[model samples]
Target: MFSSLKIRNYRLFATGAVVSNIGTWMSRVTQDWLVLSLTHSSAAVGITTALQFLPMLLFGLYGGVIVDRYPKRRLLLVTQGSMGFFGVVLAALTLSGHVQVWHVYLIAFFVGVVTVVDNPTRQSFVSEMVGPKQVRNAVSLNSANFQTARLVGPAVAGVLITSIGSGYAFLFNGLSFIAPLVGLTLMRPGELQKGHTVKRGKGQLREGLRYVKGRPELIAPIVLVGFVGTFGFNFPIWLTAFANTVFHGGAGMYSLFNILIAAGSLIGALLAARRRSTRLRLLIFAAASFGLLEVLVSFSPFVWLFCLVLVPVGMMGMTNNISANTTVQMAAEPAMRGRVMSLYMMVFVGGTPIGGPLLGWVTDTFGARVGFASGGAVTLIAALAIGFVLVRVIGVRPKMGLRNGMPYVELVPRPGSRAEGELASAA
Candidate 1:
């Protein structure tokens, strides 16, 4: 599972990434808490989240085009530095006792702007570092790395926020950029597995869009993630409301919720690393299960029960994410990887601009339970819809059977076609 770390360059990158990821998580928790404290409203928190991702929703494709034309490592250096700088700016503002809600909004939007390039660059760079064979493993490890950080960062940030202040969390995040910079600097250029970069040309954005439009395998997963991400992944708004309004807790409770999810996510990533396939069937099942769990947990009458359900929720969510990521990365050609990943990330995250506020409004207008369940309902519906589309596209029919006195459904492929083999493995 850790095989990807044997490579010297990838090892360096992973080490740096983990450190930065921890700080990123810390900032995330602190940022949410800070916004809630200042505004005392989940809707406000949602707006803050929305502003941060709005840039990606608007210009994410262009960022992909730029990533395709540039060297990923070099672009990473610039983007990472900018992120750190923004963190420090926010830290300074908070530490000075002059920070306002608008200040946070402005900075968050800037960070989102930078993320457009950084997200795709970092994703496509994995292939360059570890090559094609190790891409799936490396991707799993990366998720594991981020989830491990999620386990520690939020808890630490909670304590720090209560004892010191949110400013320190931001400061730590800013300083964390140094690790990635150092790692990037130490890498040997001659050892890199470089791919062909797209030339500077017109219609590159349209070209990327057209590329994704024609492929059902890519479009299916992308559409599934787009709906799931926009609706199902608005945990920030839901968790904050649940902690503050439902459970009557503070930052500690919020942090605990995140830690639980992170634990499950870590387990999911590790399990994914051991698996050899990245089938669409797996993606659909995981997503369906995740949505169901979310819907059930939304009605939890006790905090303990609610928290208990989050573990599996995190696991299935992580599984769904890894499956989609690996499928897209493996399907796209190397030359088009940056643009493809950019489009994927665009839908996966850029939808936050719409989902964040909408979910926040739902949580605010109705209640946390209603809001959470609504999101889950949308996710479950989307999974089933997309699964049906895939079935028709692949010309697979469902066969019902009884096994061990239990009923089950399976996809049977058409006779004398390649889809039969695909369905066999995918099923």
Candidate 2:
């Protein structure tokens, strides 16, 4: 699982990422808490979250086109620095007792603007550092790093937010950027394996859409993630509402919830890192399991049971994410990676602007349990719908029976068909 760290550049990247990711998590927790404190409304929290991702919804494809034409390392420097600047600015405002909800909104939107570029650049940059052989492992390890940070960041942020204030957490986040900047600066340029960069031209955006539209495998995962992300992954809104209204707790309870989820996510990521294969069927199963768990957990009669169930929810969610991500990255040609990944991120996170406020309103009007269960129901339905589409696309039928005294489930191609013939020859 740590095999990717043998490459010096990736080691540096991972080290820096862990530090920055911790700060990122800290900022996320503090940001949500701050908004809730200010507005005393879950809808406001949803709006803040939506503003932060709105740019990706509006301009994600354009950002991908730009990434395809530029050097990722250089682009990262600018984007990272910009994000750090925003962190500090927010910190200064909060520290000065002048921060307001609108200030947070403006900054969140700007940060989202920068992310339109940063998300795709960072995703495609892994191949340049670790090479194709380690891409899946590296991606998994990256998730592990982020999840590990999640374990630490929220706990620390909770204490800081309760004791010192949100400003210091924001400050730590701003300063955390230094680690990544130094890592980027220290990398040996000669060791990099840069991919092909597209020249400035027209119709590239349309070209990318067409590329994905024609491939059922690629479209399937993307569509599945779109549903999961938009509806199921609205954790910020759900967690905040549950902790505040349902449990009648403060930052500590919220932090604990995140820590539990992160611990499970860390386990999932490590498992993914050890694997050598990415399968669409596994992605679908993971997603389905994740949604079902959410439904079950939403109705937990006790807080302890609710928290306990969150672990597997996080695990299956991470598994679904890594599987989909690795599948797309590995399948796309290196030349179109930036555009493809940009589209992927766009669909995955961009839906937040639409889902966030809607879910928040549900939580606000109907209560957290109803809101949470509704989102889970949507996710489960989407997974089954997309799974059916994939079954038809791949010409496979789901089979279930007893194998060696154990129940087994698998997908088998239709008999006497082209896909079946190909499978038989391969076997």
Every model's TM-score: 0.93, 0.93
Clashes of each: 0, 0
Report clash pairs, candidate 1. Answer: none
Clashes of 2: 0
Residue 55 Cα positional deviation in candidate 2, in Å, after optimal superposition: 0.4
Q: What is the lDDT of residue 214 in candidate 1?
A: 55
lDDT per model, in order? 0.90, 0.90
lDDT of 1: 0.90
- For candidate 2, lDDT tens digit of each residue in 147-202? 99999999999999999999999999999998999899999888888667999999
Any runs in candidate 1 off by more than 4 Å, and if so which? 393-427
Clashing pairs in 2: none
